[model samples]
Target: MPRRVTVLEVGLLVVLVGLAGCAGMGTSVESTATSTTDPATTAGATTADTPVSTPGSGYETRTVTLRDENGTRLATVDVWVADTFTKRYVGLSDTSALEPGRGMLFVFDGEDGRSFVMRNMDFPLDMVFVAADGTITTIHHAPVESDGDLTEYTGRAKYVLEVPMGYTNRTGVDVGDRLRVDGA
Candidate 1:
């Protein structure tokens, strides 16, 4: 029988793979491998923040594909999935560079209170909030700034996708478009 991999192990492996994939072009990517916080804290962390390797494995890294209106595959990116508390909190905060085809995806438990704040963001990003049925709900083009009144985008979504700035406008990924993932 094949040995089974645990969720923590797979999470670590994906993070390692992401770090390894960032060699040469820019600086290295660091893992935000922190312990899980209490439920109260997690629920209160509105500002803050998986894969079978697909269906079976617990949080595997996959190639996320963004398609146009007529189902034309526009871009395929190797994204780090943030399904954990630590991953959610440390999302793209201190990363040196997010290459042309790389970004982070945030998956939450429910489909409400999905707000994002640019606390430690170093690069401009286009935030796309997705509903439970994979429909795009809202999109925000966020910049790298942390003001006292940091803007918070709240929507009804179970998934939040953060890509490089202008990606949405440039690729024509409108509000009703959908996102598909391969190699989960």
Candidate 2:
């Protein structure tokens, strides 16, 4: 006995026939369509929605209290101490208010020659790249929102000191100034 053809099967066959007619576009075009339309295939495209790393990351805050030669408290900065990708990459951005005695300190797990740039930043900052021995390698004055203008401190450093603009000069934190990082 022959089976009867159903309307649902006929409709599916017609839809497949129509899709087959439109199939031979190109490998690149097909792959692009699949990737752009499917969430699993287009996972990388959504990475931009992820939050950027910065001082305001949801990491625990570690206080880095500063003192002068006279043992006077010069500044007390609330720093996010984490050797993670998000914290290191995000640095300091979107900070509308930076208290006079506060700053962010990025501690690298290892020592290497590193450089920094200011992009998407709301305000200026003074970058003090410090070596493992608490010696400052280089100091750069990063300008505010100066897109594509990279300020690099070329030196082998394990720590990056980020403070408000003019804070370095105001506190007399010079290139030769020895930085004491958490009793180091």
Candidate 3:
């Protein structure tokens, strides 16, 4: 003779199984939240030489050297390289202040007529446009707009470097000069 389970026993068994399933679900959700919030596990974690995240922006830094037509090195700059579309779109807008000898370099696939604007910039900048052969095509001394009317600076370039205002004048870097990036 076998003993049959009572109606109350079956109901209790169902409740216990449901509670077990919920416990597993809670643990999964908690772990997912923790991983997402942890900086080390995040997507843009910094590496030894490539810092993907800086104070105000997430960009990798590179060393750029500007030279005259005679191959005389004029200046060396630590620049944030904006190679992708997203990085180029954001640019230096998030940066609070660019230290001396520091700037941002935008790289494109090919040389073309490009336009840049000082959108939401806290400080002024000197935009240098470079051709495919590393020759500079144009330099614009852009000032901060107080009237909220942004101006577009257009030039033919495969690379565009933006530095502190008056950087070109101070360094004597003008159009027809050349620029080279280290470990490019």
Candidate 4:
């Protein structure tokens, strides 16, 4: 027999969806896509000893830029592209501080539909999901919380860019903004 949804349950769902939308997240939970900027990946990178515009997890760094719809420069973020499986799996898991103008970019193979959780995160973050064509789809704020529930932070995105908590608001990065990656 099909399960019946109570009025309270439906109401709660509606409220939650509304809240997610207000928080710059999509109503439905989904995975992200590739890097919006398509930055080139190199083996040698700035390790813990060196912090020259370091990115989350201090992996191979790339220059990623976010611009407004009007072609205005917003932010120049130094990011580590998570192109491999291992790198993508351990993305910013135990990071405490992600300096200004720095973050991690999760680049997937194709159009992705998976959600990300804040596991072992010590600082708040703003995850920007971008399409393969470099279109910003959704911007989600992932607070420092446990990953027990694995609360998704984005919708059907091809690329996911995780930045500082206030990066979006501070830089005026809104959905539909086209971004580019330098030296990709």
Q: What TM-score goes with each of the models?
A: 0.64, 0.59, 0.68, 0.67
Candidate 4 C-alpha lDDT tens digits along 1-184: 1123368855865686689779875334422212211122221222466433222343777787888888887767777787765466556664544344457888777766647777556556778888888889888876776657766665666678886665677667899997787886
Off by over 4 Å in 3: 1-58
Deviating ranges (above 4 Å) for candidate 1: 1-60
lDDT, ranked from best to worst: 3, 4, 1, 2
Best by lDDT: 3
Model 3 local distance difference test score: 0.64
RMSD of candidates 1 onward, in order: 16.0, 20.2, 20.9, 11.8
What's the CA error at residue 117 for candidate 1, in Å?
A: 0.5
RMSD of 2: 20.2
User: On residues 90-172, what C-alpha lDDT tens digit does candidate 1 reach at each position?
Assistant: 56565544333556677777666466777545456678878877778898877766547677755667777777666777666
Q: List the residue pairs that clash in candidate 2.
A: 53-90
C-alpha lDDT of residue 107 in model 1: 73
Q: TM-score order of candidates, best first?
A: 3, 4, 1, 2
Query: Which tens-of-lDDT digit does each residue in 62-97 have in candidate 2?
Result: 555444445554544556554554455445544443
Q: How many angstroms is residue 179 displaced in model 1 relative to the true structure, after the best TM-score fit?
A: 0.6
